[model samples]
Target: APRCSRDEAEISPFCSLPEHQAPRCSRDEAEISPFCSLPEHQAPSCPVCCGPIRGLATRLPSCQRSRSAVTCRLSGTLLDEDNPPLVLPSGHVYAEAAVLRLEAAHGGGAFRDPRTDDVVTMGSLRRAYFL
Candidate 1:
């Protein structure tokens, strides 16, 4: 039987048992083993495991679907140079007049983005310039 290392013995109580008495710690068994309770054996956080700011980089682009084809979510009409699209803070694109009308309907107060539920104001809307 293979001997447990000093560090492994200290972390795993089963390591102290005799070879014949001890149950094998296979990779799958280790997941549910009592040793997993140790802080050092815990899973790493997103930042630690993936590197700082990697989460943001790995995230899918919010406007990926809209970039390929432009359409107003509010008016359900194809967007063109004549009726340009404006991008909301939540990344949804809508017709400029449609957004203005929506804002007006809410008494010019902050409105909730339908896609992500993010609060947005007319001042924060920007033109979508895909290149």
Candidate 2:
């Protein structure tokens, strides 16, 4: 069966799924799609890329690890579209929310670096962009 796009330029294991089972979201649809965050409409997350999910197992094949998965150093969770990995000036990486929470716990604008015991301010944080 023809499971992938007719364009023939891109190939992925996702091509094997039925039309209805294909991903509901596309990279360009973020600004226009309304169902991106709806659980029933979201595609199943890859197990290896997403780490351990609670309550229910992931639908992504556990046997094959995604080559692009990058995990957050503090939480060990995948740095995916939902949870971005932010970087501190001291050369440390952490989840976006994790850094924010740590700063808030200390005093709101400054947080102690988990690695070097140095104080890092929110102004020194940088966004880590991934492909």
Best by lDDT: 2
Which ranges in model 2 have alpha carbons more than 4 Å from their true place? 1-66
TM-score of each: 0.42, 0.48
**Where does the lowest 10-residue lDDT sum fall in candidate 2?**
54-63
CA lDDT, candidate 1, residue 34 = 57
Please give the range of 10 consecutive residues that has the lowest summed lDDT in model 1.
57-66
Cα lDDT tens digits, model 1, 1-131, are 54665545544567678888875544432223354345443334322123454443223121112234556756766677877899887677888777777777777866767657677887898898756
Per TM-score, the best of the predicted structures is 2
lDDT of 1 at 3: 67
Instruction: Tell me how many clashing residue pairs each candidate has.
Output: 0, 0
lDDT of 2: 0.62
